[model samples]
Target: MNKLSKLALSIGSVPAWAFTTGIVLAAESVKVNPPKYSVVSVGALLSGLVSAAIIIAAILAFVYLVWGGLNWLTSGGDKTKTEEAQKRITSAIIGLAIVAASWALIQLIANVFGLNFQEGITIPEIQTNK
Candidate 1:
């Protein structure tokens, strides 16, 4: 499609918040109950979300670090530019380390809180005579 048509189509599409609100408000008096937790279970998707957050943060941090290193290598010993790049690399490492540590901390907290995200318990089966 032409650029103008693409722009028009994009603009014509309903904005997410407005569309969500329209649907939400249209549903009058609909109720949703909060999820319940059992003594042995945690909410589904919590662990997956935690791991996804760590992975995303690590990838972003690594990208920034590589960009910074390239900038530093190209600085030709210019003090200001080199120092700024060094700072960027340092901050990226710190950020990635913090993200990694946060993942560990979350697991520790989960264990302490006795939460398990597995949906079901497993049991071994016994062999039967043919």
Candidate 2:
């Protein structure tokens, strides 16, 4: 296969590798402490994933903004290039604003529900008779 196809194949396999690794690690943990996996753990996992996604997106937005600034500086009186850079910067700013608004909305909902996003998830214990 060509280089582009090879690269695509490698990238496509990454999620499969991650999924397999996660399953293996989870199974090992279950073998060590079966009680650790519960509703609270799942909630905590979801929360962590969401936080990570937000952080990654914010970082990407900042990087795009910087890239646009660089492009603008390097345009050197070219109208088309300058306009493209301006568009990039504007889009990045808009994306950042949307992200901020979403974060605020999440915080507001969490507050209304009396939930702390920073805190670990709380799940009531269930009593089982052997």
Candidate 3:
């Protein structure tokens, strides 16, 4: 082989050798672990998720109402801008109402089903010999 060909082959092999060494080091350092969480049952997980959603919805509605009020104040007496701001405020109110209704519905369903939120939902576990 010519000198140029040998030089090119050496340069190409350097990257391959570096990548193989890096992969070996990475593989040796990697460790497997199960994720830790307080919520064990599916019901508990869902309850937490629902509660978070309700809080976020309420916060977003309040922010929307504030934004609409600001827009109205800065509208400079333009009729169209005022109308749009009014619509935005109205939509924010509707969103709040929907969130409240959903909460009530969830409470009603939970009551009827006797699902207690205080005590996390219990699910039966099946045992098998390892």
Candidate 1 lDDT, 1-130, residue by residue in tens = 9999999888878575466643334556868766574333234455555666788999999998998999999999999999999999999999989988887787677678675434432233679999
Runs in model 1 lying further than 4 Å from the true structure: 1-42, 117-130
Residue 49 in model 2: shift from native, Å? 1.1
The Cα error of candidate 3 at residue 64, in Å, is 0.6
TM-score versus the correct structure, for each prediction: 0.54, 0.65, 0.65
Clashing residue pairs, candidate 2?
none
lDDT of candidates 1 onward, in order: 0.76, 0.82, 0.86
TM-score: model 1 vs. ground truth: 0.54
Clashes of 1: 0
For model 3, the stretches where C-alpha displacement exceeds 4 angstroms are 1-37, 124-130
lDDT of 1 at 55: 86
Clash count for each candidate, listed in order shown:
0, 0, 0
Clashing pairs in 3: none
Residue range 1-130, candidate 2, lDDT tens digits:
9999999999999998886733333334344545654434766776677677788888899999999999999999999999999999999999898888888998898889787767654555789999
Whole-model alpha-carbon lDDT for candidate 3: 0.86
| Model 2 alpha-carbon miss at residue 79, Å | 0.2
